[model samples]
Target chain A: MIVADKKPIEEIIESVKEFKKILILGCNECVTVCEAGGKKEVGILASALRMFFLNQGKDVKIDEQTLERQCDHEYLEEIRDVVDQYEAILSLACGVGVQFTAEKYHSTPILPGVNTCFLGATEQRGLWTERCQACGSCILAFTGGICPVSRCAKRLLNGPCGGSSKGKCEISKDVDCAWQLIIDRLKALGKLDEYEKVQPIKNWSTDRAGGPRRVVREDVAL
Target chain B: MLAEMEPPKGVDISVMMENASRVKGEIDAFVVPEMSNAVMRMSALGGALLLQKNGMDTVMQVCCRDRNRLALQADLLAAGASGVKHIMVVTGEDPGFGDHHQAKAVYDLTLLELLDAIEKMENGHDMSGIDLCGSPQFLVGSTVNAGLSAQALESELSEMNQKIKSGVDFFITPPLFDIASIKPFLSCVDLSKTPIIPTVLLLKSLGMARYMARNVKHVHIPDELVRRIQNAPDKARECVNIAAETVHAIKEHGFSGVCISTIGWEDKVPDILKNIS
Candidate 1:
């Protein structure tokens, strides 16, 4: 899932300081699962903002609403009737959702409430680690199910670069050696022979290095 | 003849070679290590140029972790033009391993990809099919792990064979505490003509030895050696003696010359060389 972290209250206050009336919009999808910009978080942020304004002797009107999914147009239409009532919206969604909401709303200032992190999986409730870079070209099949581009510090297609000590990356003890894991997994699977096959230089056009990507299928397209 | 050494502080060659002169005749070429911990110093190629200016042959170590193919190829051609004859290609340590934790690593090309590009350049063309006015020449080398688990040896060798097939002129192994530790790796790979230079690191203290054994990947320090260093009366002297002894053992095993990673203990290299010779 696309992970995001809640913005600090101080930063959020600074962003909306100029506006007295604002809508705190939340997403029920990735931000919800990550607990950043979901319904519960939106409620907490609204209360916090209200308390801040009350303490400052300022009256700020804040409205809270959580969309099923901020990225889709269907869920976004529900906010059109009320969006004009507020000066701005503090979106508690990933970057994609914020942009989508802004595109549809057109004039309302769409403010981000959370920092979008990466495409990752939750190791536990509080801990999330990156798993994929969405590099477009996936080589997990050759790497024993591990993603080198996301996991390897150098993103080396052929590596365990000389700095790996034990099974850890040279950058830190906390990071695992992606190549080491690949070799170990291949060894366990009795496919160690595959480890030596050097992959060609990557054509990064399929990755973010190329540009914003788009996928179109004629069969599904009208 | 390549003496594996760090770049001098501020890249002051005079101060750097002051200690290097102690082993003048012993080392014909010097190999400079790339920056560790993201702490800036003289670049590997820059250090090699300094050494070459001093009348010593040098091998500039290049890593794929930081530079893209364009930068790498540019550096290689620059080194060749400067008369540097050898290159040691390495997949550099992750930047997180260094002090600069936030630096983004640009592993644009893998070790194989870099090596392949070097081979292509040697054959008179750039990676993008741009023909060079003059093809640069280099004796390309790479590093390998000496200590591998029995189960992982085949996989490691496959990587080694790939390096060999990519036109690596020689393979330099990580530091070896015991010759026996590398025998399993050696027996599996055919190194009939290729020279396998075993690295010998000077273990300064029990802590250093233990840290390497427990933390460094693919490096195995024997328990006996660790105990010996732990119990030694004078660790400094014992470390030198052990290094000299290992160099002798490596030579006796019919391996190519030793690459001693002195790690600031270069002052004692002459003694180690004298003792071994």
Candidate 2:
């Protein structure tokens, strides 16, 4: 899932301060799961903004709404009638959702209230860890399912560099050495031989090095 | 025959130059390390160039920790053009180990990929397959961890073989206190084709020895040796004797050569090599 973190309340206040009427928009997708942007968060933000403006003795109208998924056009159209009522939308969604909302409603200003972090999983209730880089090419079969591109400090294909000590990365004791994990997993599965085979120089063109990318699926196109 | 020399942390190279001149006739070449342990310093290329200008042969170490492929290739070209013939490629220590904890590590190319890029440049093409007007050739050397455990030794040997296949001319092992400790590595690699130069690191004190033994990954400092340093009345002299003895033992074991790393005690390098000849 796309993980995100809420922006500081001060920054959110400053961004929406210029507008007299504001809409606090939230996404019910990945942002909701990560606890960054959701229906509950939208209500909390709206109440806070109302109190902030009330304390300043200003007449500001604050409204809250959360779509099923902000990226989808059908769910976004549900707010078409009310979107023009507000001068700006403080979107508590991923960057993708904010941009999609802006594209759908050309006149309204869409401001991101959360920082989209990475494609990751919730390690526990309130903790998230990155798992993939969306590098277009995957090599998990050889590496025992651990993603070096996302995990390793160096992203070394042939690794466990000399800095790996006591199964921890040289960067931090908190971060586990990705190569150590790969080696341990391979050893457990009796597939240590896979590590012996040299992984060739990566063709990075398939990665972000290739620049902004797009996928055109003729079969799935409407 | 190679003695490791660290570049000065700041601009002044007078001390470094003086140390190199002290051991100029005694050692074959000075291996200028590139920010080993991730501590920032003047680049190895700059120090190597200074020594090269002073008519001393140098093995300038290059690591994939700091530079991207373009910068690496550019520096390699600079090294080649400036008459540096030996290049030791290492995947350097991570940035967190050094002073700059927040600096982003740029391992844009892996060890294998960087080696392949060097090979490509030698063949008159860059990594992008663009033709080069002049190709730079180097005697490439890389480090191999001489792991003690059976699993680790197997993995090291496999990586060593891959390094050899990648056109590494020779190999250098991490510091070894006991000669018998490298028996596993010795049995695996045929040192005839690609000579392995074992490092003889100067153990400054018992504390350093204990620290390295406990914290360092591949380095193995024996308990007996640490006790010897602990027992010695003059511990400094004892440390020098231990380093010199390791070099002598390396020669007796029939390894091609030895790399003496003084680890900031550069003045003691002459002392370490004095009895070897």
Candidate 3:
């Protein structure tokens, strides 16, 4: 799922400083799953902001609302009635949701309350790590289920770089050498013979390097 | 000058002291490796500061894979404040190769970008065009690969040129088993502008040589070198002899000096140096 982190309270306060009335919007999708921009987080952020404004002696009125998902137009339309009650919106959704919400309410400014990090998975309840770079083509199968595109620091397709020492990356102990993981997984699976296969230069046109991408499904197109 | 010390895992002052004292009279400067093995230890910058406090000239190894532009600048400023003037800038190994399997890497700047940033700071400004309170002066260095396939050779040579253009004062090659292998690479370089420091690793055993040959990238371990170590009756003496010979060969090729990595055999450094002088 797409993972995000909440922006610091101070930065959030600064972003909405000019607004007297504000709406703290939340998404019940990926943000909720990752515990970043969920309804609970929305309340926590709203309370923090309210307290901050109270301490500052500012007459700021903040409202809270969470949608099932902010990416869809149908869920966004629910805010059409009460949308005009705020000067700005603090969207606790991914970048996609914030932009979609902005498009939905043309007049009101939608401020991103979270920093959209990457396409990742939650290893534990609180630890989320990147899993994919959304490169158009996938090579997880060849790489023994490890995505070098997302994991390898240099993203070298052939193998681990010279810097791999004691199975750790040169960067930090917190990071696992993706190629090491790939080699280990491949070794465990008895597919070590495939290690010699050199991956050719990737077709990056399918990746973001080409440009902003679009997908079309003619069969489902209305 | 060969000061080789790996970055410590925690703030172990005793180990730092041992490391500092061991190379006291042997090397002119000690190199504090960046977060090697993917574990967060005392940072190279922090380690350099500690060594400098102990009265040793330290070369802080800075990698581009970790910090962004702002953090890099701030750290460089801090290094200058701490009186560390020598730095070896590297396009560090990826974080994915480290212990932290889930850490986010910030490769906001490339090696060229980093060297350029330092150069700009030396001229009295930050990357954002803000005037600096004080300028940091550094005798900057960079790492280069020794043995290379025809493909990597060209690209790496081009990169070395770009680094020199960005104001790198010196270049250090990876731990080389055979100095002759780098002759092709050296021929391509304009040595007058950037002096090359060839590094030699003291091979402890055949297993060590083979392991390095297979796992360590860019290191060239010729078949004969491995065979000699494997078949040698006195492996320890042979290791020192080979290292000493490699150092001699590098100097014979008209290079200034060589960087020796004992690889935990710090005691053997004096032996290797004995044969060299």
Candidate 4:
């Protein structure tokens, strides 16, 4: 899952003020799963703006569409011909989808209506919280797959911080201590000895600081 | 009763952000925001917001079918923060007819919780303990279908009274075909003293009348209404005509005003309002 919060209606309407024809676009990928840039939210924003524009005596031709995935070129191509008809596009997808849509269409202006927060999971109905940092490192086998960089407040590398009390973080009492989780996992795996090894400083350059990392499998690609 | 909220000074229809700014003295706002899922499902919530913004002395709706508790509370708080005057509480429809069939529906806070939440909201706290920078005041309303008669009349009266205790300042009755369905309901209330607005339902299509009657229980659709609509060349168009007459009937019955419920034919609301005047 992912996390996203909707932008205010006034700001959204202001962005598409010039477009007499607008297509409220939604994404069915990560955005829809996270409840950020989904079809339902698209309707919400479109209706809000339509009312706002109509009240101001401005004419607006508002239509809504949700694609399988906006980030993918193939999915966006479905609307290639139709998009040319609209004056502007209001994308409810994440930063990735919005960028993709903008890249695909040269003539139309694409505006984002959601603030994409993070790659996360559905904690409950209508609630999405962060889970993955996409840091290009997987210590899941060693640290129980709970990335401390994303879950831990301080990103402590070793055992629990002194701030840990009752397995909860000092920053927020409701939050669980990530390092404490890592320690418990190490114990269960009989790798408590790894804790005594005195960990070296993290090499982020090898992870993602270098940027745009890719993976390849000869068999799969072939 | 909500008509009193506007300051008697002058007109102030410009929208204020979720801030301290408010529209001063404007009655009868035209709250008709565009409907969600124009491909299928339509809602009056948008209209409610638009009308409130334009200073129509609006009565907005808090539907049960849309958002869960979090979203509902946020929208309600936002509505109040935006200076919405009145709200008509309703149980919204499912999303099958719309684009979002898989989209979840939340009824976490029953009508009671919603009412309680709104009342709590008046004190500056949302259900989540987030305080509003400023207080929000709105006249709460509840929906009642006066057509049901299987239940005892006393039980029906008690239900209406219960919602009243739950913070509903006004009540909007659902649409009815013959006076029989509403007559029993009227006998239960002393409308001479009460301000509860009696709104009748308008059948927009023969398919719609049959659709509603088939799906909803105890909702009385007049036989003649069904027959007349069945005979019409353009049943969908005739629905608007029947709906308009229902509004006129509601007005003739000495009710303060009618809440035109144009479920499938959402566009017919403005026409009904026009005919009502």
Candidate whose TM-score is highest? 2
lDDT of 1 by residue, B1-277 (tens): 4577678658457656766766767797788877744555778888888777878788788888779999999999999999989899998876556655445577899999999999999999999989998988999889878688687887877888899899898888888888887778878766557688888888888888889989988787889988888788998778888888889888887876778888776777777787774
Q: Each prediction's DockQ?
A: 0.02, 0.02, 0.03, 0.01
Assign candidate 2 its CAPRI class: incorrect
The interface RMSD value for candidate 2 stands at 10.7
Better of 3 and 4 by DockQ: 3
lDDT of 1 at B105: 70
Candidate 2 chain B worst ten-residue window by lDDT: B95-104
Q: Mind listing the fnat for each candidate?
A: 0.00, 0.00, 0.00, 0.00
**Residues B137-204, candidate 3, lDDT per residue (tens digit)?**
99999988857758889998888889989989888888877766677787777666568888888888
Give lDDT tens digits, candidate 3, residues A1-222.
999998988899889988899999999999999998999999999899999889989999999999999999899999999999999999999999999999888999999999999999989888999999998889988999999899989888999888988888888878999999999999999998778998877765567644467999999999
Question: What is residue B198's positional error in candidate 4, in angstroms?
Answer: 3.9
B1-277: candidate 2 lDDT, tens digit per residue = 9999999999998999999999999788899999988899999999999999999999999899899999999999999999999999999887767876545577899999999999999999999999998999999999988755589888878888898889899888888888777777778777776698999999998899889989987677788898999999999999999999999989888888999998899999989988664
Model 2 Cα lDDT, one tens digit per residue, A1-222: 999998999999999888999999999999999999999899888888999999999999998899999889999999999988999999998999999999999999999999999999999999999999888889999999999999999899997788988999999999999999999999999999999999977655556644456889999999
TM-score of 3: 0.56
Best by lDDT: 2
> What's the candidate order when arranged by decreasing lDDT?
2, 1, 3, 4
Q: Looking at candidate 1, what is the lDDT of residue B7?
A: 84
> Where's the lowest-lDDT run of ten residues in candidate 4 chain A?
A203-212
Candidate 1 per-residue C-alpha lDDT over A1-222 given as tens digits, one digit per residue, 9 for 90 to 100: 999999999999999998989999999999999999999999999999999999999989999999999999899999989999999999999999999999999899999999999999989999999999998889999999999999999899986788999899999999999999999999999998888899978766577644467888999987
